[model samples]
Target: MSTVKVNDATLERINELKEKLKISKTLILEIAVGNYHSKFFKKKEDP
Candidate 1:
């Protein structure tokens, strides 16, 4: 599980970007999760 905290201004910006790019909430969330995973695992060298 992950938790994100955004201020009102940031939330508005995200909403605006979502509308402008025509992206859905699900896609945004997936991208965020993928990014988080990559960052979290970046220190471990792959075999």
Candidate 2:
């Protein structure tokens, strides 16, 4: 596990989502990172 520091606003949002979705903070971050990677990073086709 890694420790990350987040601003108050971000922490508030994360907590809101966690309560709304009934998921853990770690899963919230994981899903967010996955979405970010999918949106910003393209996968290269294998030759």
Give lDDT tens digits, candidate 2, residues 1-47: 76987899999998898797766766889999999888666654333
lDDT of 2: 0.80
Of candidate 2, the 10-residue stretch with the lowest lDDT total is: 38-47
Question: Which residue pairs overlap in candidate 2's backbone?
Answer: none
Report lDDT (Cα) of residue 28, candidate 2. Answer: 88
What's every prediction's RMSD, in angstroms? 13.5, 12.5
Candidates' TM-scores?
A: 0.42, 0.38
Q: In candidate 1, where is summed lDDT lowest over 10 consecutive residues?
A: 38-47
**Model 1 per-residue lDDT tens digits across residues 5-47:** 7899999999899796776777888999999999878857564
Q: Count the backbone clashes (under 3 Å) in each candidate.
A: 0, 0
lDDT of 1 at 34: 96
